[model samples]
Target: MLSSLALALSCLLIISPNTSAAPNSVPAAGQSIPLIRRAQPERTVAEWESWAKNEREALTAKYGGNIEKRSTGTNLMTNQNADSSYFGTVAIGTPPISFNVILDTGSSDLWVADQACTTGCSKVQLFNDLSSSTFHNLSEPFSIQYGSGAAVGTLGQDVVQMAGFSVPNQIFGAVTQASSGLLNPPVSGLLGLGWQSIASSKASPFWQTLASSGLWTDPVMAFQLTRFVNATNVNTEEPGGSFTMGFLNSSLYTGTIDYQALPTTPSYWILPMKSLTVQGNSITIPSGSSSYSAIDTGTTLVGGPSSIIQSIFAQIPGSQPGTGSWQGYWTYPCGTAVNVAISFGGPSWPISPADFQLTKLTSSQCVGAFFELNTGGSAPNWIIGDTFLKNVYSVFRFTPAAVGFAALSNTAVAMNGVNAPAPSPTIGSVSASATAGTGGGSNAASHRWSVSCASLVGGIVVAVGAAWM
Candidate 1:
C-alpha cells in the first residue's frame, strides 16, 4: 500500500460497543440520537473561543479560512449576538447556554462552556444558565483537548437544528473551559466531523447518538461547502451554506454513486492503494509503508513520504529546481507545465495526469501544489486529492461499516481497482533543485520502479494534456 496523510484540527469521532452503550439507547430509527440524549451541562463563551484560535491556525495554512471574530451588538451577560456568515450560534452544556461555533471538518470534538468551567470559560462568551427552557443536566462530566487547547464540560443534550436536519434532543458539550471558542467566535460551539477527538468530550450526542442507536440507516456522512461572501466574513445566511452528514442533493452528481470497498484504520475510513505508478514506471519505496490513503473532505493537500513523492516527480519533465525550502515548504520553477499520471490499486485502474497535478496557488508558477502535504509528521503515505476525487466517485462508509471507491473514467478499466505495478526505489527527499522528469527508470538498488504508462480504461491514456479538472 502507499502512504497517506490526515489533517483536521477539531477532530471528532464517536464509536462504541453496542453492549457498552448508555442504557437510554433508543432505537435510532425511532428518533434522532441527539434528541434522546442523557443530560446537559453549563458553559462559558470564553472557553470555546480559545479552542477556535489554535484549531484555526492548524487548519488555515493547510486548507483555507479565517478564525478571527467580531462581537455582536451586546456582550455576554445581557444580549446574545451572532452573524450567520462565518459564525454559527448554538447552545452547549447541561443547563445549556449559547456560544459561537465554527462548522469545521478538519477536526472533530464538540465542546462548550460548563458550570465547572472557570478561567477559560469566562474569557469569552458563556451560555447564560437562565435561558433555554429545555435545559437539563446530566451527571457525566467530560474533558477534551487538542494539540494544547483544552475544555472540560458536563454532558447534556440540546435541541440543535441546522440545514433542515434537526435533533430535537441533540447532545451539547457544555464545556466549563472551552478554548476553541474564546474570543473570535464569542458565539456558541463547534460541530466536529473530522478524525480526531478529546477522548470523549461531548454532551450533544450528535452523530454518535444517531449511529449508535441505529437511528440512521447509513453510517456515512458527507459535507458540501459553498464558499460565499457577505456583509461580514461570515458563511451564515448564504444561499449555498455549508451542509453536513448528508449528500448534496444536486443534478450534477445524479447517477449510480459507486462505492469503493473500504477498510478500517483505527479512526477514519481508508482506501487501500497497492502501489503508485507514474508514467510507465512503478515508483518504488520502502516496504511496510502506509498501504492506504484516506479520503478526507476536510483536507486539501495530499501529504506523503518524501522519497515516494520524488519518485513521481521524476516523471514531470522540467518540474525540478524547486528543491529549496521556503519556511519548510518546497518552491519550484515559476512556470513549469504540471502534468503526470498517478495510478493506485494495481495497473488496471490509473489516475490521469490531470488528477495528479494542481493549479498554481499564486500568479507565479504553481508546481506540485495539489500533492503538497506536510509529511513532517510520523507517517509515510500520500493523499489522493482533487486530482483523484474530481474524476472518481468516492464514498467513505463510516466505521464498522464497509467503505468503497469506484472510477467514472468512462473507460473499460474504469472500474478496475488498479492493476499491480512494479515497485521503485527511494531516491531522496523531495527538493526544489531536482526537476520533474529528471530521473529515468534506472535504480541504484535491487528494487526497481515500473511505470503504468498506458491505460485502456478511458481509451485516452494520460499521454499529456492541457490543465483539466
Candidate 2:
C-alpha cells in the first residue's frame, strides 16, 4: 500500500524482484515505472507556513548559514529540507525483499533500514542481508546525518532490482540504528538518483551503475509529477505519474524539448535560469545572485532568493508577508490566480495557479508554494521543486550532461485543470557564466556533511549527527 510522509521530503520507489533478467542484462530499450503521488493531509496556513520556515532554517544551518562557505572548496554535500509527494517501489537481495524508498535526485547514496534497526525503523520494512545469498558485508561504517536524527549502519552489496531492471552487487547502507521518526511505514529508505561525485558513500548511484553496465539505449531519465491539491478526486494516494528510463515518452509531453547545459563540473542537475516573471511582469533578480537552479524532484516547493520571492508575491493584490511562526513566507488572496513563469534559455513555461496555492488561511488568503531561500553568493540561488515541475515534463540526460523541459501534453495538463498557453519557439542558449562561482569550497574531504531530516520528514527542528568510518 502507498503511504505519505507527513512533512517529509523526496520521491519513493517500490521494488519487486525481477529474477528473470540476468544480473547484467539489459531488459528493454525504454522502461517506465508508475509513480504514486502521496497526498499530504490538508493543513492550516499557519502549519504550512511553519513547516516552510523550519525547512529553510534547517537548510541554512546545514550549510553554515552562508552557502558560499560550504562551496568555498569543500565537496558540495547532499542536504534536503522539503516534502515528498511521489513514490514508487524497488527490491534488494537475491530473493529480493521489496521496500518503499524515496527517489531523490538531490542525493547520491542508496540506504535502507537493516533488520537490526529496532528503534525508529520499527514501522518500516528492513533489509535482511543475512537472508540474501549474494549479500556481502563491506565492514565499512555508513551514517546519514538528519535534521533531527541520523541513520547509522554499515556498507554492504547485494542485487537491487527496480522496474524490471537488476544491478548486481550494488553498494548500499544497512542502517542498524536510526533516530525516531526517520523511516516511517511504507517508506523505508532512499534511492539517490544523482552522480557519484556528491554521494557521501562515494559509491555510484543506482542509475549511474545501470548506465555503466550498458543497460539503456539512452542514459537519461524523465519525470512527470502529478498534482492532487485541487483535483476533484482528492484521494490520499493516486497514480502520481510516470518515470521513464532509457528513452523519452512522447505521449507524456508536447511541443519541442528545450535543453540546458549543466555546469563545467556539474554535481547536481543544476543549470542557469534565464528569467522569472509573475502575472506578466518580470521580477528583477538581485545582482550577484548565483542565478543557477537545482532541478530537485525531492523538494516539494520552489525556494529562491528572499527578494525575488517577495517581488513575485507583491504582484498579487492582497498579498501579505506571513508573521510569527509563518515568518519568511507570504500569503495571497485565495481567489487570485497567480500566473508565474520561468525560463532556462528557452521558451518560457508557465506554472498552474492551482499548483502555486499551497494552503488556505482565513478563507481569504492562501499560502504560496514559493518561499524565501538565500543560498549565499556562490551556491545555487534556486531549488526548483515539484511546485514548478508539476507544470511541465522534465528530462535529466547524463550523456551530454544537460537538463531538458517540455510542455506537458493536454492529457497530463487536464489532471490538474491547468490551462496554460502554448510556449513560444525555442531561444538560443543562455550564458552559463552565472554558474561559474558554484561548486567551490574548502577541501573538507575528511569531514562528512550532515542534514536535518527532522525538518524534512516531520515538523520538528532538531540537530543530529553521526560518525563516518
Candidate 3:
C-alpha cells in the first residue's frame, strides 16, 4: 500500500506489557508511507460522502453492516500548554484539585488518582491531592483495563469541568503503573471518545453518567481534526479544532449527515465485508466467514484474525509472511510497485500509500520504518487506524441512541501546523508514551484534493484531484 505507518496506540500496546498485550519478540516490518505525494485538495461536504458509502451492501450482507445517525458530544479534548507537553489544569472543589488529561479515541478508561492507592501510584498524577484547596477525592475509586495494561485507583466523587459540560462526581480512571507514559499518556488521564467498552468501565460511564443525569438526552460525539504537516504558529491547547458532543445539532456542518445501523457492539462498529481487492483485483479472502469486523475509534490500527491479514499480505507481490512475533503486518520491496486495497462491509477500497508507510524514522535511509503491526497478535483481530479513518468521516454515539454511527461528508482537517510527537529528547530517554506517533489529530491534506497516479490491475490507472467537491 504505502508504508508501515502505525497508529500510536497499536505500536504501544502491542509492544508494552503494562497494558494487556500480545507476546513480543524480534520486530518485523510496519506500514509504509506513500512514495509519492499527490496534489492537495479543497474539501467540501459532498466528496467525503462518496469515499465512505455502502457500494456493497447486497453483496456483503453476511460480512456485516454499516450505520449512520445523529448523535451528541461532550468535549474530552484535554487542554494542553501553549508550548509544552503538559496538560493545562482546572481547579475543583473546596481544596482545589488539578490533574493532566489526554484526549484519546483509541482506548477507553478514564483513570484519575484515588485516595486509597496512595502508595505505588504516586508517580502518576493523583486526583485526591488537596493541594489546590478546591480538591476533593470521593471515598469510592474504581479502575478497569481491557487488556491494554491498566492501573487501579479509588473512584471518588468530584466535578471535572472542560470545554462546556461539567461531569460531576464522574467515576473515571485512576490507573496505576502509568502516571507518566507507558499506558499513561503524558496527560493526567485519558478520555474515551472511542466506545469499545464504554471506554474503561463496561457499565457506568460518561454516557451512562450523562444519560442518567439527564444532562444530554442523547450521546453523540464527533471529531474534526486539523491537517497533517505543521505550521509554526500553533496552539495545541486552544491552538485549533474542536469536537462536539450532544444530540446531533444540524447547525454543526453545512452538509448532510448519513446514518448507519450498529446492531451489535462486541466491536463498536462491526460492519460486514463484501470483498478484498489488491490494486482493484478481487482476491480469495473470506467475506462470508462467521468472523466479523469491528470498527474501533479507540484502536488506531485494524487488527483481525491471522488468516485474514495473512491472506491480504500473501497476495502482495514480493511480500512474505512474517512468523513468530510479527504477523498480520506486511512488507514489500520499497520501490517495487505496491497497491493495497480494503473493503469495509462493502466494495474494496484501496489503502493509500501513505497509510502503508509505518514511519520514516530516517529521512536519509528508510530502513527503520515498520509496517503497522506484524506478530504481536494471536487470533483474528483487526485494528484499523488512519488507514481507515482518513478514508471515512466517522461519528460515535453512546447509549440508547437510535443511530450507531454517523457518516460525515468529509474529514476536512485544518492544522495550525503542530506535530503531536514530543520534540526530540535531549536530556534523557523521554518517558515512553502508551502509544507512538500521534493519532489522526489532523486530517490528510488530501481532503482538499488528491493528485498523482499509480497503475492498478489491468493498468486501470487512477488519479484523484487535490480537492473534491
Of candidate 2, the 10-residue stretch with the lowest lDDT total is 69-78
Ranking by lDDT: 2, 3, 1
Q: Judging by TM-score against the true structure, name the best candidate.
A: 2
Indicate the residue-level lDDT of 78 in model 2: 16
The numbered model that scores best in lDDT is 2
CA RMSD of all predictions: 25.9, 23.4, 27.1
Report lDDT per candidate: 0.39, 0.64, 0.39
lDDT of 3 by residue, 1-469 (tens): 3345565535533433233323454344442222334887976777666544445444456567542222233342322333112222332333435555444444444555444453344555555545434334444434443323344554443455443344544445444343222232334455544443333343234433443344553556655433232134444444323455555534333344444444454233445554666555666655442344444433333554556655655655666543333332455655543466655543345554544544332242111111232222221234444445433445555554322332333323333244554322111111111111111111111111111111121221111110000
Candidate 2, 1-469: lDDT as tens digits: 4346632222323233442445555545233234335998999999999899779878998887842211000011111221235555667887778776656676667889898887778877889988999998887888765323567788888877666556676778888887765564556787777777776677767777655544555667888766766755344345556666566778879988898888646577787778889999998774323777878775567777788888899899999987755566689999899999998878888998987887776688888878776553344677787788888899888788889999999776664523222112111121100111112122213122232111431132211111101
Order of the predicted models by TM-score, top scorer first: 2, 3, 1
Which parts of model 2 have CA positions greater than 4 angstroms off?
1-84, 146-149, 178-181, 286-289, 376-378, 414-469
TM-score of 2: 0.70
Listed in order, each prediction's TM-score against the native is 0.47, 0.70, 0.55
Q: How well does candidate 3 score on lDDT at residue 53? A: 49
Error of 1 at 306 (Å): 2.5
